[model samples]
Target chain A: DAGITQSPRHKVTETGTPVTLRCHQTENHRYMYWYRQDPGHGLRLIHYSYGVKDTDKGEVSDGYSVSRSKTEDFLLTLESATSSQTSVYFCAIRGDSFQETQYFGPGTRLLVL
Target chain B: AQTVTQSQPEMSVQEAETVTLSCTYDTSENNYYLFWYKQPPSRQMILVIRQEAYKQQNATENRFSVNFQKAAKSFSLKISDSQLGDTAMYFCAFGQVAGGGAQKLVFGQGTRLTINP
Candidate 1:
């Protein structure tokens, strides 16, 4: 199994507060992605990084930002938490090879009130 | 733009039985990749199977197999001898061919599968 860990497995914050979720991978994968899962909707991509300092927005990039300063670490931050942002977030890593399957982290559940 | 569709919102199967999950996608690109991911109650997403549009033969992984029909834009997953561990939310995803450095996965709504013991 790929070594991937998500810090703060569960969090509860008030609206308008700042929240940060961290994803650390022991496998030096070139591709890292952040996604949110909600009921009735599948996992929606929020942000992804191809390499250190190289990041891009995904389908649901609003209200979220990401950074990757090192190959093993990827961080997702919510500038200001909102009730709508409450959901389960997952981090995935994949190799540079085409058609490679992604390995996912356990996931972080966030609740905003 | 590419989109994945899973018509069945929920399904149930008896243990030791065979069950098939449906997935259909819309894409203009001739070459791409399709994947099935299983998210168990633990919320860990695991890859079940994958199919490349360029490949004519379907892809199978142990108890999981996929029926890939490129012309019809359909890719469905079949699970043989289902077990209680198979209960989870299944998502069908589509990804573009690897040319660009960044490839984002587009996912379907997801189908909840319950395996009865």
Candidate 2:
């Protein structure tokens, strides 16, 4: 509903392989975030960008990297996939307003063998 | 660090009944915000309700409302006239009021709700 889309809705790959997940937003919000959801752990932020080329690490930023070259595109990359990295990834965007509600994407389910 | 805790992992409510989901958070900041998000079997996350810490009155949206106790540091969601479609996983989140007016949310593990026919 927020015009947010996450590409590669489902991905299965082997360990040590490289993988990338993309999140595209048509709203052109000022903030974008990447999160991983796992059973019992809920959703944890991995990386976030406030503007193009302005990014920051989150609570669980290890082994993952992100890039936001433009306002509409945010990408998450796994340099070398690991089994522990398997989870459902979600992308969210929020306006520049204070505590504005965030809009989420459908999510991408990734599995590492 | 701020933390949100959802005590109930699984809960069930009969159709047309009312149910309350409990959420407690730990934060030292006086100015902040709380939110409730719902994720159904479709796995699409949806916002249910929100409450500002500075507000004394709770927030309500249709059949959904929040009992925000700032002193108690608790924010709970109550759903009235629950329906089968209400079944989903609910998450409670906290966000600090940033100086620049940008809010970044910290979320809880979540509670799975099942509405029985």
Candidate 3:
């Protein structure tokens, strides 16, 4: 447990509406990541940040955007929510360079109507 | 490009039994990492074990150990003394440095394991 938390453990939104998920970490880690877990596909990275204001796209970054204004918070935004985008999103942090072990948050389950 | 495959979609075993989950990957990179993650009903992703491609010896943690065959491109997790607490969805992933130096991962489909009483 690296003191990571995700906001709105559960959320329901209508298609075409905007949605944003927040990932907060008290670990003060240099690296932060956002991933979406879908049945049969396991988990896929949506986006990641190496530092404040430094973000990069992931394998599945088409419909998602991320912003890191400070070291403590990273936000993932879906400009327009879609039913296909419904999935459980997880936040993670990497503490050191020696170990590749990334600690994860509880996860946020989003449902689109 | 890299891909990880977990052939077993589900498995069940009696408590205190031993269980092995299969995982295979395709990669051309010389340096990379393999990992097993457990997701319980609570939906928390927990790292069970990790294996470095360059390491010759398999990695283990307590009751969990990995059979890492680099030449075969296989990494399997064997859980000894399985308990009800081990019931969860297990996922295997392949990782390497991406274009931006951030670790990128490709995960397997996942295996649902159940520990029976």
User: Local error of candidate 2 at A14, Å?
Assistant: 0.8
lDDT of 3 by residue, B1-117 (tens): 788999999999999999999999999999998999999999899999999988999999999999999999999999999999999999999987864466777899999999999
How would you encode candidate 2's per-residue C-alpha lDDT over A30-108 as one tens digit per residue?
Answer: 8898999999988888888888988888889999999999999999999999999999999999999765888899999
> Each candidate's DockQ score against the native complex?
0.70, 0.60, 0.68
Q: After superposition, how far is residue B43 of candidate 2 from its true place, in Å?
A: 0.3
At residue A102, give the lDDT of candidate 2: 82
Worst 10 residues of 3 chain B by lDDT: B96-105
Candidate 2 deviant stretches above 4 angstroms: B97-102
Q: How far is candidate 2 from the true structure (C-alpha RMSD, Å)?
A: 1.2
| Candidate ranking (lDDT, best to worst) | 2, 3, 1
Overall local distance difference test of candidate 3: 0.92
Instruction: List residue ranges in candidate 3 displaced over 4 A.
Output: none
Candidate 1 stretches with Cα past 4 Å from truth are B97-100
lDDT of 1 by residue, B19-81 (tens): 999999999998788999998888889889888888999999999999998989999999999
Q: Of the candidates numbered 1 and 3, which has the greater TM-score value?
A: 3
Model with the higher DockQ, candidate 2 or 3: 3
